[model samples]
Target: MKKLLNYFFQGLLVVIPISVTIVVIYKIIFWIDGLLPFQLPVKLPGIGEVNIPGLGILTIVVGITIFGYFAKFFVANPFFLLLERLLERTPLLKIIYTSVKDLIEAFVGEKKRFNQPVLVTVNKESQVQRIGFITKNDLTEIGISNQKLAVYLPFSYGFNGQLVIVPSENVEKINASGTEMMKFVISGGVTEVD
Candidate 1:
């Protein structure tokens, strides 16, 4: 009975993650598909008009890509800049807008902030350390010491994190990709760092 239980536990370890991942993806695709508002059927070679699943997701992706391309080198760029300026002028909206924009830009913008993963020395006496990303390398403009750097230490199993000011010497650069390190940290170190 113990041997059988061991096998069952091992099986669960393999099956649960895959099952949950598949179900989540399936649900997300259907949710995005439902957001299309109107479904246009396409006629295939042999089959009659058929409504394709996930067409909305495809359309949204293509539309966003096209918009991004145009906005990069067209009149829309100035229009967006003006809109952004107007949003910045508003009191409460400015804070929320800028924060959200900065958060998104930090991850996917041209100047990616989380690319540099570092190991910060939390307790030098106990030789304890914590993993974090260097967000701001320079602090002179902010009146902080140049030797001190801004580090964002993400919490395990959550999207929130705390920012700390650490001495440059106390932070050691880790040789790994940001995405993998983020996954490793978010998974509470349970996921492999490959």
Candidate 2:
């Protein structure tokens, strides 16, 4: 009974992730297809009049590609800059826009702040250590850049993390990819890498 139950659960663990992924993708595609404003009766210019169920998803793809291309090529730089300026002028919009922009840039932009994984000595005297990523090397903005650095320590078994400002002397940069570090931390140290 124990062996059979173990095998059953092992199979379930393998199948559940794949099943959930497929279901979620299917639902998202369905939702996007359902966003069609109206059925095309006659032929249109770019796309001919066809009641294609997946056309909404296709349109979304095309729109996002065009926007990304424009943004990448700086074709929409002036417009975006103007919009940012306008938002910065407003107190509420400034906070919201800047926070969103900074978070996105930190994760996805050229300067990926979380890529620099390191081993931090939390308490130098007792040698309490922790693994984290260097978030900020330059603390000049906060007026403490002499020997201080900001590190983000991700929690085990959770998505949340804590950011701590520690002295640069206490941090030892590690030679590990961000994804590897994240996976190890998320798995609660179950996963190992040589």
Q: Per-residue lDDT for 68-182 in model 1, tens only?
A: 8887887467778799899999999999999998999999998889999999998889999999999999999999999999999999989999999989999999999999999
Clashing pairs in 1: none
Clash counts for the predictions, in order: 0, 0
- Scanning candidate 1 in windows of ten residues, the lowest lDDT window is 71-80
The superposed Cα distance between candidate 1 and the true structure at residue 187, in angstroms, equals: 1.2
Model 2 global lDDT (CA atoms, 0 to 1): 0.85
Compared with the true structure, all predictions reach lDDT values of 0.92, 0.85
TM-score to native of every candidate shown: 0.83, 0.73
Model 1 earns a TM-score of 0.83
